[model samples]
Target: MMRAFKSLFWIEFKLSVRAMNLVLFGLFSPAVVAVIIGVIYGAKPAFDGAGYSFMAQSFGALSGIGICATGLMGLPLALADYRHRKILKRFEVTPVSPGMLLFVQVAVNFVYALAAMAMVYGICRMFGGGWEGGSFLYFGLSFLLVTVSIYSLGMLVASVAGNIKTANLLCTVLYFPMLIFSGATLPYEVMPPALQHVADIMPLTQGVKLMKNAALGLPIENAAVPVAVMVILAVICVVVSIRFFRWE
Candidate 1:
């Protein structure tokens, strides 16, 4: 079982690397958006929020949202399309299990997310964004939470989507609201009361909240709420996604 799983994983990885378009879509688009935002508002303060540096906060928030858009959107659409085309069904006829296929896809996407994040960090650093948080463990944990949450959510969407087009459409529909109100591009406090209420339910908002707290070395309690929300989302998505996932 382990050997079969490893073979299946490598096959998926090689396919993903050869699919240049998926790499571009999954990795490049978010980096572009981050660059545009950094160029436009890189020098400006993030907001008037007390004790928070604007660029640091913005870069942190941007990294969180970029992960969401890339992972949840690009990863699921590709998976759904592969399944819709019976690619997964072909694998099913082999010694490979459906679970292994899902795991491999998730692993590939996590790598893509990490690469996109590196681009975000490097560009932000070039543009004068500073990392005030001294602890690598803190950053790793926060990044892990957000990445797991988004990846699980992507799996959930892929299970439900019948085709690539539908998955693409749905992912976009789900992403924009979070970007707008979740303190990704815009801070939640500046939003109107109604919008703030809506944004509170967004997983990325919670993800951003946790990321900011970690980046700034704040008390764990400062991140507890958002981390809890992300964990819940991840759990729910994983259960439902596995239950409903289709190979063709």
Candidate 2:
């Protein structure tokens, strides 16, 4: 099973790179948005008295958002295309299991999301950003949890979607509502009570919360709920994705 999974991972990774649209869409969009937001917010601290750098927070938020976006949107689209092409069906005929395929897809996307995160963090640091001490473990785990959760959701999307176009459309429609309300673009504190209630249920919002806590070197207790939510969502997604996944 381990060997099968590794083989599938390489195959999916190659396919991901070959699909230039997915690569560009995943890599560039959030980068552009992060740059714009980071530049604007990083220019001046929201309150000079707070002794906080707004760019650091913005960068952290951007990293979480970027990872979630790629894991959720880009991954599903690629898998949908594979399903549409009968690639999944072809694999079904082989000794490789659906579980292997799904795991590979998730693993490959996690790596991509991590790479994107590294790029974002590097860019921020190059521009004079700094991190609070004692946050490395929290940040690492939060990022890992969020990435895995969203990657599983993308697999769920691939399982349910009929084709690449439908999957792309569904992912797009689902993305903004979640993203906007997820505290990535707008502060959760600024949201109305109803909206905040809605955002609280969203995985992306939980992701943002985790990222922020990590960036601030806050205690892990502050991140416990979000981490739990992400884990639950990931489990649900993986189970449902397997239950409904179609070979052809």
Candidate 3:
């Protein structure tokens, strides 16, 4: 079973590499944006009492972007394509299960998302914008929670989508709004009060806030709400996806 999983994972990884859009958006784009932001603001000093530099905040936000791109966009599209092509149906007659294929897809995309985050962090550090946080453990936990929650949402989309085209459309509809309001694409500070309230309700917004605070080494206040939200969201989505998943 382990060997079968390994084979499926490698195959999925290779297929992902061959998909130029996935490579571009899921992997390279965040790194590119980090480099650009670092070059532009690398010299700026940390904001008053903000603990970390502006570049760190930007990188933190960009990390969420990469996570969202892979978890919310790439994963669903790939899984939907598999369903559309009847790949999942074909797996049912073999020793390998469709559940294993889904696992492999999730594992491979999680790696991609982490690699993208690492690449963005490296670029930021190379440009003199390394993280100023003190607690690696806390940051790791926050990152894990955000990634799992977001990926669960993707899984929900894959389980419910009827075809690749619908998956892509749904992902797009979710992606742009999350990107815009979550401060991944736009600065959250500059958003109007009403808009900020709306953004506050978004899961990614809370994720980004948690990540930014963790990255900045700031004491996370009122964190219970976001943490609970993400945990609940992940659990519910995973349960629903598993219960209603379609192999064909």
List the candidates' TM-scores in order: 0.86, 0.89, 0.94
Number of the top-ranking candidate, with lDDT as the measure: 3
Model 3 per-residue lDDT at 21: 64
> What is candidate 2's lDDT per residue for 4-67, written digit by digit as tens?
7877788778877897654665566556666776666654553557545665666667776667
When summed lDDT is taken over every stretch of 10 residues in candidate 3, the lowest stretch is 43-52
Best-to-worst lDDT order: 3, 2, 1
Model 3 misplacement above 4 A: 46-51
Candidate 1 ranges with C-alpha deviation above 4 Å: 47-53, 220-222
lDDT of 3 by residue, 1-248 (tens): 99989988898899888887668998998888887787778847656675457787776788888889988898888989989999878876888754566568789888988998899889878877768754678778888898889888898899889988889889998888998899886879889999999999888898888787777777899999999999999999888887788887
Candidate 1 structure quality by residue, lDDT tens digits, 1-248: 88876776677778878976547856776677677877776756666554545556665686776577656776687788788888877866777655566677787777777887788777777666646663568777887888888888788888888888888888888777766788877766678998888887887777777777667667666566777778988889888888887777
lDDT of each: 0.74, 0.74, 0.84
Specify the highest-TM-score model's number: 3
Candidate 1 is scored at a TM of: 0.86
Q: In candidate 1, list every pair of residues with a backbone clash.
A: 46-54
Candidate 2 at 13: error in angstroms? Answer: 1.7
